[model samples]
Target: MPLFTPEKAQTTDQAKQNCVFMNTKDYDDMVAKCQIKPLYVQLNGVVFLAKPLAECPKDKIMLNANQRKHARISLLSNIQVEPYAPQHSDYTDLVQFAIVPRKALPFDSMNSDLLQKEAISQLIHRTVYDQPLTLEFEQQFFDVTAKSQTLQIVTNTTFFKFSVPHPASKNLQLTGDHVESAVVKDSQLMRFVKQTQESMKQKSDGQEQPTDDDNFELDIEFLGVGGCNKQFADIFRRAFVPRLLPPQIVKQYQMQMVRGLVLYGPPGTGKTLIARKIGEILNAKEPKLVSGPEILNAYVGKSEENIRNLFADAEKEYEEKGDDSELHLIIMDELDAICKQRGSRNDSTGTGDSIVNQLLAKMDGVKQINNVLVIGMTNRLDLMDEALLRPGRFEIQVEIHLPDKVGREQIFRIHTKRFVAKNAFDPEISIEELAELTPNYSGAEIQGVVNAALSYAQTRMMNAQAALEGQQVSLKEFRLLKKDFIRALKEVKAGFGKCDDKQIQLIQQMGFLNSAGTTPIIQDIQNYIQTIRNSSIKLGTVLLHSNSSGTGKSSIAAEIAKTCGIEFVKFISAEALVLKAATEMERCNAIVKAFQDAYKVPEALIILDGIEDIIMYTSEGMRFSNQILTTMLPLLKRGQGRLIVIGTTSKFYGMQALDVTKCFYKQIHVDGLDKTLIDEIVQEWCESRNIKWEGGKASELQCIIDREIVTIRALLQSLEQAASGCNEVQCSDFGKFFENTW
Candidate 1:
């Protein structure tokens, strides 16, 4: 069943002669005689026919019958065969001789066609000088040629052609000449290849021109124009610009535009929020929000390495992909943790300085790597390295200050918009007035006020649940809620409640004038005491130009009785009037009371000591409040009793508005402390108590205090909160207090 085998073979010369004759029958006959079934036959280096063993010719005659059968069997079973070797001239038909049983092929039997062709090829090589033979098949003819002793083989459908190497003598001079010629040709070809390669490279480099789409610039608007807020925003925006560009191209441009930005301010001023908003506005492609702690590394150089890798990776991404829109914004909040002031010897220089130097170099390095923006946020800007702030570096500095009246109003409206939209108020109160009352209120404080008001309303509704209170929050409820909201705010002391130089000056001015007025003694005392307390003096004086109703005198006296630091109290009435007995005895007792009060509390003064009553004749006749003249006459004398005092007036013009006689110590015409001062007092008071100053700022403080001139009782109530731990005073506190008093 095998197509070919070693047992059935032919002499190479005989096979070659047969192939030259182009006799298919003879070839088949010869193969049959040899009992060789040629599955594939190669002639003159060309394959003529290749078929399976079973498909090969089966007509070759063999003896059959008794003796003939025995001979045929002997021929089939014991035919003598020998390995074929071709003479040099036999190469002409080498292709035919190479075909044998597929199994007998020297190469792998599985690929007999390929092996036959290889054998023919080798015979051709060995006999290159031998003339090539032409074989004419049914459709075509083959021609084989040999040149320079190298085999040139060609095959057609009908014929195969071959050329073989010719033998030549070796000559040193000639060989050298050929070698030199070959080298020169090779050198010329290599130069052309190199030139072509360089040209292609140049074209590729040119195609990568930087585009605007790869670069981005952001403009962030911040709080104060002249303050750190704007500077910081600008610096941050610049830092982000280079990050938007292709790093490689951007580097080529050598424009180091992008750098880190840092913002710092008071705690509640919204520093972090503003930074986040900036990121949003810039619309970073890939924003990395990191805290200061994230950059810290335990290993000496690891942190710096990590930082370098972070930026490097970003740049590499842009360079490799050529995506211009890719942006990596690294926002480092609390930047002070790692980038602390540089010169501290105790700090870890290797770790800290490495990070600092690396960050510094990356931010504004001369190399101009684009596509990375670093933003640093901190509450402690003072603690950062100065190099980080240099022009090419962070460059921009922004500071957010406490909101002013207008800003407070805007903030209040922003926070309360939801409530207002729900029809919480029938007629909205003047926001300007609210803003005025909330002095030193930050954005957080305004928001807290709105929240407090809403919370108060909710609480009230819950308490009235059984009454079937409507879901709607009414104007009345809102007002009441607002009042309670304000009152609660007075308990926080952290904001602007602490007395500063301006506040102290205002208190001193108010306390001076209240003691000089002379009207009905009781009324004068009331006016003076109210003015001093409303000024938020905390420690000061009250002088009353009054007599009679020492009950009213004692009432004012009792208001600041619990003042912890320093407070003075004195009552002037009929008993002292009698002791003096002068026509101006009542006024003299009023002055004496002021002196005694000052003596009692050298640091503070309360002047309502002893005075019964005073009567005065007015321009309209009919004995008008003479209490004013009687009180002023003694106060004008200026004796040992010259400090500060509170005065009241039941009747105006009952005494001169001013005592040119220099009678009373210092005259602080008692009217009312301004809206700003009132707001500050409440804020200060609440802050001391550790209460949150939610809404109701300085202006609001003033509005509530001024709504109805602050009375001695109101002052006592406001001050009483100081004992309850509500340190910071807010406008809302005074508003609630006033509402309750009403």
Candidate 2:
């Protein structure tokens, strides 16, 4: 039995008087009687004739045709014409027929009318072998009728009640080779047959609906641990501690989850990398990495819509999977770009604040979106809205700072180990020394230095490869060429040089020291030098303040000697004062002995270079023990004739604490040149090398100053490289200098 019900007559009176039969031929008359025009004529509940049933004049038909004969044949065959009605009893094997009129129909019944007509047409063509079938109908004019017995007929122009066989009893089992199995099975095909239906009743009463999976999970891994300090890592680890528990325990405990974390730092300090690493460490199942720019939209209100969509989509994904354990990590890089402070009326209105507001609302609306963690990275945390950083939002603020000496050395080792394995150089060249020398170098700078060294080595190897048929870089070649590698390390010019001459002169003039004879002199000198050096004067003592560098101290002292118009003499320990050659007094006498020789010279400047090696600071931070001070006091206080004893100490503070300040009339600090001086030196160097400074070359000189305000020696070397093998000092040539210096 079919589920479809068709209009049917209940009584004999209604069946005989109201029911009307229609064929393709009588469709027009039937439609006319009902004050409608037939659009399609049906047979066996399927449309057999769908052409317009109106009559057309021969002339009108011929006007549109290539030949009048063709037009006349189509007009007569395709159009429906009147036919005799069939009796209800004669329609015992009646096929259902649907009649569609050429007028607007109600929205609800229009689809059914079209589908019935189509199904009837298919049945006639396939099962009925294109044979026409008689259709009988009983029409009722009453407004009301019984719900089950009522037969409602809807046409394009009017509503009428029709009596026909019950739709279930009239079900035609479609047959024939022309029937498509796919069409019979297709729901859409069934809809075309006026059998469209949807199940409204619940499958099982009182059965609970299955809940959607609302949980998200994520697995994050930190590769190449980002440049986060141990403290920061600890904080991050603590924040995600709960996530490390077993699933069952985690569910039972209801851990206080960390929702958001922010990484703040200067540009190029690896905030983004740290954020990424933290995300990896958290090990969320679905971590969404989004750049701040992704949230912006071109149209007004569209950015807010996008933000909403992003969260909505994430929730939808969790829901669809029906998994509560899924973790969602939203990593926002350059967050300051999209979460700026709200603008005042005077400021341009559109900005990150609007987007920030949307994010804030979403974040606050949910108490425990357990699996979702928001990590934001910003170089300019100050520019972000305060609301974004408040207690519940990005509460965990981690700072990513420039690497310190130990960190830099670790970074350098990581970067250069490959190069070291390939090239032959002293592996013992002191990374500690390198770290000390690279004062303010960031991790990126350390990498650059290593890369520059490798490049230099490659260039040398390339030249050598051309000369020698196929020779690996030999130890000798690496030693000779590895000067470039050392040069690369020197490029970052850590401004850890000695104090300058002006500072030394100022300390002397300040009368911080009192001259006395023997023991009194050494003690007074030590006190004066220490006081002046450690004072809060804008400039400290002018003594060379470099670390343990023998060559640097010697060169600087010799230069000062020459500048001061004094005979510079190196005082070897053997020629100076001595007690027992092995005793502590002997070491003190050795220093005093050197000073005595310089004091004997009327105006000689003695260079006590590498003083820390000769004299050690006592535990009191004073340079030289009391016993050594006793031996040196006499020579220092003697003040031989007009001699200006210029003792250069690399460790000036250590020397001061030794109470050796009274010996030298003036102390001169020799530090690295300022940018202005460096620039002047570079200009002079370019001129001396005959390198033309064309194309606003002064600016290029200034850039070098800006990049690395190095020592006079470093600046000179850089300038030489900038001018090397070129008549004109082009800006491009500066790269070699920077490569060598950085």
Candidate 3:
């Protein structure tokens, strides 16, 4: 039962006289209104003894049933009080004349806790008064603390001032200033910052600040963490600073920070670097960074013990200090090795199951340790146990995906800054050009490109040194030329198995990226391909459908297979299959042979281009046997791990008549290029051709839509004519090209 005395509506004086409960905050206020003595009050129709204490005791209420510092009074009551507890007692108590509805709400009488789906959202208007007794009288402490009277916050090195509004007023004035340090000294603000710093200190056990590893600042180039400031801001501030915030303020706002976070993504995208930097910023005490192999033992129970030992230090501190425990961060790299889905283990040892259970128990099990943070990094999120990823465990998941064009530019600037600063770099080597060249490169891969260029410069010096055997090599003339970077581009190959620029943007426009919440399309496609390869099911069909020709369906099918890292992708059309055949019978045999040949490869995307033509389809009043249709249907169903048939067709009505729509498992509609993609094509084409496209972007898009469904090929052809030895092509030129071509 709720420990409250429900009361009916009465006068303010009567309400005060009858009220039986109060909190620590309202202890003095309640004392001013009433006498401190043993009294009897009605609780759930039963009478109980209650009293107000002379002092707050043991940080706990002495009148309540349990040894708790605070009581959770229901928000349904309009009145509130802060109850005082005697210092020797362990229980903290506050009794309230809870507003009992004349008719009970449907939510009442269900249970001690409400249902999950139903939540109470109410607007609370509160009043505030300051306690002059709590204020410090010393002037020196006041002088040092005056800076934070106008509160300021920082993000991306820019400071913005903020002020607390009083209950009666809506506005609060503030003054801004530059932030020369992350340190704060004001008494109230220091309560938050100092806690955050100490929590960070727990990772390293308050180790002395290290000497500079290099004279150049990491912020100057942001090495190992290039191009990630914007994305990092949200995760860093939320995870780091919020925990540093005043606990009462945080509770008043109904917000929480998860101690467990996972950073999972592709290889070399800098998940570990981000985790290390975070640990550094938090100043964690002996921050543990372990790879999966380090903990996995051959012995069954030993593996689980290793997992326990990882948290022993932090758990011990939590037990000793309770809420005052320091922050502990454990970064587990390649987490899928041990945390595989609980029952997914095939071994007789059952070690995987034990390891997963041990990790989960440490995270949110019965003990409820709050100071430890587990940061798990993995390339395979799918292979991990489902229970561990849910809320209260590793709930904060962020994907460290490959860099985009702009991100790539920022990365390039960082990687090449050293050479540029020393004036040993080529002026013609544009950072933008290099960024554009490597669309899906990871941070490590981009760093490799810089290494490759340095390697070339070394080779040039070696060759020069060989020419003059006796004299010292001319270090003065050693410089990186534009050709050296061009050479490195060929030798390094930062991005190998990725989609072309156009294909990537096209996929993005098709809402593939919008569907991706934490994983990028690259990972999604790889996972899908792996499923198709490993699953017991035999067949899957992907259809690329468009209403008109030149939709680049064949190109897209091959690109999809390529981006999926499939090496053998075959394109089959009537011309390639039937040119050598002497008769219709021979042509059918050849087509069947090509399909059979495709099945030989371990995972091939066989693109059957011009699907209607492949089926002896004709529109000029000609009829054909349904033998081809029958043979293809069963063949599609029988396809196993080796073959994935992707068929393309401009005509959907023809497929309906043939009754072969069911053969295709997934049909992706290939449509006209959206404006964003159109812009990329136009700008790149004009740039290469040394021609200017003066046509307004909106006008061109509208004009194309106004005319007809514009294929990328047709758009390029039109652009070609407009840029045929012209200084600039205007919107009017597009009209001429559209009219003349279409």
lDDT of 1: 0.44
Best by lDDT: 3
Rate residue 112 of model 3 by lDDT: 10
Task: For candidate 2, write residues 1-742 as lDDT tens digits.
Answer: 1111122223343232212222334444445554433232332232222222133322121111211121132433333223223222221122222232222222212223333443333323221211222222122121111111111222232211111112311332222222111100111112211211121113235565455454221211113332344535445354554554333354456555666788776555566666655554442444678888888877889888877765674466444432223456788888887888877324465645678888888665563355467888886777788887876678788876666666666676666555567665456566677676665456666666767766777787788877888767564565323466578875533221223345344333211211101223233434543554355421122244443332133444444433443332434332232423676766765566555444333233444544454454543534355675566555555544343334556566666655666455555454445554443444555565566765435555555556533444454455567666768765656645754663
* lDDT ranking of the models: 3, 2, 1
Q: Which prediction has more favorable lDDT, 1 or 3?
A: 3
lDDT of 1 by residue, 1-742 (tens): 2222212213333233212221345445556655544322332232222222222234222111221221232334423222123333332322211111211222221222332343354333333322443322222223233322322222221112121111110110111111111000122122223343454356467675444653422212222211123343344435443433333444467655545567776666666766665555443444677788888877778888777876776676555533232456677888888898766538545677778888887777765544556677786787799999887667776666665555566566666555568767435465676676665566676667656666666677666663665465444454334465455455332253233334333323222222222224435544554555466443333343322221133333333332322223333444444566566555555555455334322234433332113333333554434555555455434334223444433333343443321343333343433433544554454455556555554454554545645543354365454334554444465465665652
Better of 1 and 2 by TM-score: 2
The regions of model 2 sitting more than 4 angstroms off are 1-223, 226-229, 246-254, 279-282, 309-313, 320-323, 344-348, 366-368, 420-428, 469-482, 492-742
lDDT of each: 0.44, 0.46, 0.56
Q: Estimate candidate 3's alpha-carbon lDDT, on a 0 to 1 scale.
A: 0.56
- Worst 10-residue lDDT window, candidate 2: 179-188
Considering summed lDDT, which 10 consecutive residues are worst modelled in model 3? 123-132
TM-score for candidate 1: 0.36
**What local lDDT score does residue 392 receive in model 1, on the 0 to 100 scale?**
69
